[model samples]
Target: MVSFNKFLASVFLAVAYASSSIAAPRPAHSKFATHRARVVGRGLQVEAFHPPSTFQTFGEGIDHPLSKRTESTMEDSAVAFVGSQLKVDFNTIAVRSGFSGEAAKHVFLRQSHDSIPFANAVANVAFNHDDKVVAFGSSFVTPNSIASSSPAIPLEAAIATAEAALGGKFNQHPATLEYFVKQDGSVALTHVMQIQDGEAGIWFEAFVDAHSGELLSVTDFVAKASYQVLPIQKEMLTQGFEVLTDPQDMTASPAGWHNTGTTSATSTSTTAGNNAIAFKGTQSSVTTQSSNGLNFIFTQDPTQAPTVAANVDAARVNAFYLVNSIHDLTYKYGFTEAAFNFQQNNFGKGGAQNDRVTISVQSSAGIDNADFSTPPDGQSGAMRMFLWDFTSPMRDGALENDIVVHENTHGVTNRMTGGGTGRCLQTTEAGGMGEGWSDAMADWTEHNSSAVPDFVLGAYVENKASGIRTHPYSTNATVNPLRYSSIATLNEVHNIGEVWANMLHNVYAALVAAHGWSATARTDPTGPEGNIVFLHLFIDALALQPCNPTFVNARDAWIQADVNRYGGANKCILWNAFASRGLGVNAANFVDSSAVPAGC
Candidate 1:
């Protein structure tokens, strides 16, 4: 069988070079020209814009006695706020989703023209409890006239076109008519639908032109974790399993990992919990009696190659432990219900609940690979871990800590970046950063020192010292030669991700040097230590940055996060770290740059 890396490389290359025949949109006559805008990708699409808040009245009206702070009231207030800022009618703004958290009330809105929603034109607004706006990010476009408000082709034709493009029949969802904004600012009437091919492991949101039977665009939903297992700091078996009681964080998982309610009652007698549920293939769940208090101690035979029949229980328990552990660890770093994290219960926090991670150990879906599928906020994300045959005895990916952490991070980045829409990281650059973030997060969890060490992913499962990538993640220039310019020639997401991950490695080193180290950084969020600071910026920047951000955008968000949290104390350190890796102040369009900020 072909290796996972080779399979992905070929797929990405085909996608990069594929030709498109859709007509481009006309030049945008933006009405919000006076506002600050951030454009990304080759399309020069305005991914985010911040309009002046001089005319905002959300705070004034919210404080009045007549104004009730209900979900409808919040939606109306957000619509009025965005309408006034964007110079559009409030009727044209459709409320997509709204929820209230402890500190803020968030409302997601979509731009509409004549009651037809714009598929990609969206805005996210957050208001503090005092009714003052805290954050606003929008990709809404200026109003433009279209040739028609309805599709020329029938819904059947559109589905057929999508199936033809994917080369398979789809287990399709309901289709809706919407306005699609093209890269060049043109608009097309289209039928948009979510399509899934389970056997092929393909899930995509496809937009088919209604005027003409053409596929305008497709956003992939499957974020492949294509690397190798977790718990005990490193890959499993490398560090023998150790049992610890009550590992769940009270604030994150108040009901504990084994329960889904608000109390600490035992909910299951098997590897099922509030954060994750692990099972083998498509069979019944592996169960244990309550007599042992759910102790899942099983022996691994070192005499021969590993098989599913021999290590099923151990694999399920390890998978369950790793998922719950990562869930709690990340919650401390702000991947909570308010930020759209995975959990079966929200405990009255915000966001759509009833969505915990579903893990399949030793899955029969595929071989030599693992993947995670992220839908919207209320849907459960699925993680499939497969067995690898690279070594003498096959390796269970569920037994690898780095691999599990790597896959789980995909859910975190996807949900956080796009206001929990789970469609922002679809571009080549943005998707590459998703992979890079996964690798960087895995690397961070393994380190507890001031002196940074070289890290490699999937080393245990791949059975190679070099791991699965082209180069080891390192801060040294000679050790990892990848820089911003390296992406100019890189086609595969994993290869492109190396450059981004290495840049983060340098950032970690610089922060640790300036501050201090935290041995307990994984569970501790309070400190001036560099490790804690890195994680704070990492999670905060995901919410601050625009959807489909480039390297520069992500770097800017980190700097902004530091300024917001630390009062700009790490400005120079951050600039110097990014500058060393060719992502300096002057870096643009994947070009190498060495210049830092003028003050730095």
Candidate 2:
């Protein structure tokens, strides 16, 4: 397994080499000189590249550079285009971030001042594999609202104030001056500070009012916390055993445990050359191991629960396997080597280092939860699967395939959208949709697993009937009863997320209804050919949405993706699914997570 430090060094070297090969900005033709514009809110702007031959529709068929490139090169291209063609003052803007996914076909760039993203120029630009500037969605604004030239408080004083606001000692990353957008659409030049407490899995960003040194806002990046009982004649329910009869507590042989690993397809190229990686465990003890041969095992089970070791090990194995499998499957559709993937061992492909995902099995107990913090591509992010034995019906979350997959999906969704660097999906509505994606993906995984699998999640531990939710997801309104209106009253993201999940469920069911279910749905996520159409459109939608997207914007992106991919072939199916949940063509738009569309 490659170390994180080694991965960074390799990237830096590759970037250094690629820097010299940067091509001069291509001249924008007369037809492509003017960009197509879309109006956002009052005085806000949204624009995209709309040339004749270059700007193809949004799917994967368009040819991209298969040659190696770096995030820096991609950003340089975008900055150049915005500077020369758009004629924006490049000095006023700072390169907030630029990232590329291992399996993605493009590198994304976020433009803002300091480290605060989406502040001044809320630009999300993408460069295809060929190192040419391809697409963008920008709400660009010049730095016009700075109250003062210099900060009233110095950097050290601002750090101290933010630390006090945090209420605990935190190892702080370098703080930078950035612009912060207020609730009332005002922007303030502030000091943005990133704090990390690895022991607690806490990652947060603090925006300090530079003029007054007051902590303007603190965004907590710490996604909350997981266990095992593996897979069938399930005896050790915590280990996924299914005993024929409840012989009280009979111990059975742990042979052929499903938790060992599962197989998924992978690729190094954009073409048909694909391979499979069977994700399973290696010969490494949980405690001392930071990584396995094929995956990274960051934390191991403690000695306090000797019996829990086997369960934890198997759960970790399954978690790694599920993430790898999903990456491979998603890759086949459009997620190429350019999109980020979690892995310790790379196939020696170009620019494949430092993309390993950190996995913690049966993390420090007390919370029955799982989370995935998706940092930038090269940077490492950890997923904690905590043991859910805090109260009654003890539940081992690690062994739950749905829970593990759901958490991993968080990483995928976060990285894929918002410039491929964990932006967007931060607002309440976007967050709810993020949660919706996790639940929908988990439900889809299980629904296709067993011949008659229950769509509920965390059934054994969270809830037997609903499983961590009010009810199992259903297309029939009475069984679920969740819709866009549900978001109006239930403001919580998980609750509001159910509405979005139901919409996705109906879409999935409708797709299956159109194209019959294929037994290999796991390997082929799109049930069949027509089913793959929705998946293709859905993934493309992630790329189209701007940072901090609302439900309506998200809904439109999917529709537009269909227009780009199939030229509106499946628009009716997509529209019917969203409209069933009150997100119709004529439905009123609501940016608030607590406010749902009025028309059902």
Candidate 3:
């Protein structure tokens, strides 16, 4: 009854139906007949992502939402036609919320519809963005975003597991096992499945809770996936080049925390063993002579401080070099003018020298952790890391150079960018970042030595018997050594350390490849033909980062900002340029966790 052409037309009409938001198959562009045949296929719907609490964007400018480009207003079009240039406001709040320094966006659209369909048209029903979705949680089934992507659990296995176990329940995101050993039995993990729609895929993970044996969380990041190209230049968030000074005569005092041209009053270690340190200022020669390591040194001439100040300029320059080595991406605020002093005599009887660096070598003989943390009213600081003259064997892990470096970074970063969010676990994103930054600097300054910089902290343990060096960096939960912070919890600290060290090494290698040899900046901002290859750019990147910000955004911000100032595509090249030998990173792996999120 139907001709061949009529039958083909009917088939084409039947295949042109639109359906689904995120799971629809993509339309294949081809012959008119083939296009119609593929029109009825599915399309994709994208979902949102929930990352960790630790987030800090690079100091470079970030974006806000509600930009003119996203919203086509009379203002946006007039400028485009009049100026002959498409203008888009990059500072909108909506842009900030919608973007995280990424270069694109993703969406779904109708394939065969020639005209704008009515609000209630069949074609309009495809993008079910507001559709209410169910999520299986620990306690009970809860509501989730419209397009939920979770691994499905087989109902058959769920019944058996619940019957055999006690109270097992499901909580929220990351649907997996949540079991409780109580009077009531719980549920356990069964199995999960994938639910597809169009050209996209959504996989959910299901598990029972402990008490109620309910679904817990889902291990899914997206319900739909596609690419959206971002068209705009990034803005600088924090930009202020440093006032370069001689790395030898002056120090780069970031946030007035380190090498502040002033001596710290507290130098004694909290674990200074049974050693009774005597002060030369208060004790007579008879009493001092009898002591083992007592007469805490003091400047004979207090007012003539610059002499002592310039003496330890090595420490200051070392600090900068140290920090740069650790952070291939960072910023520098430059040196402070305050004078270094050690006149208070908090360590032994006398204080640390008013000008020189000193160490107590034992906690019992010096200031404790609590005292060290108590900063003066207006001053934001913790001399945990830089307050070191590391020598001999370390006691337990209490007073180690590495610990000092890690802790000092916290103080510097806190002062530079108001104190961190103070997240819980020291290994959380923020804490890990802080710890890693410090570890990198310290390891860099300590470079040239045979110390194979690693994630392990405080490897040089003190000989419990002789109170000398008995090297060891490992720490266990049950060690009970008052200073023993669990390595598991501290992995965030050390892993970040290795990552940074590795990054510095990589950048250094790249620098060698790019510049024939190590970068030696003869002057501040580079003297004459010497390019300004200072670590200030990188320091600024790290310093500009918002505490607790995500690593990817931070790294991307650094890259974009560098590219904006330098050339394009060659962004990675500048990363090495900003980090050089004078900055202290003699070599690097470029494996920055920021460069690679999965590594983080």
lDDT, candidate 1, 295-412, per-residue tens: 6666556455555454777777777888888898889888888789898888878788889998988777787888888877877787888889887678888878788888988999
Error of 2 at 63 (Å): 17
Q: Relative to the unseen true structure, what is the C-alpha lDDT of residue 576 in candidate 3, on a scale of 0 to 100? A: 37
Better of 2 and 3 by lDDT: 2
**Number of residue pairs clashing in candidate 3, backbone atoms closer than 3 angstroms, sequence gap of 3 or more or interchain:** 129
Root-mean-square deviation of every model: 7.9, 14.0, 23.1
Predicted structure with the largest TM-score when compared to the true one: 1
TM-score of each: 0.82, 0.67, 0.34
lDDT of candidate 2 vs native?
0.52
- Please identify which of the two predictions, 1 or 3, would achieve the higher lDDT against the true structure: 1
Which candidate do you rate higher for TM-score, 1 or 2?
1
On lDDT, the candidate that comes out on top is: 1
Among all windows of ten consecutive residues in candidate 3, which has the lowest summed lDDT? 118-127
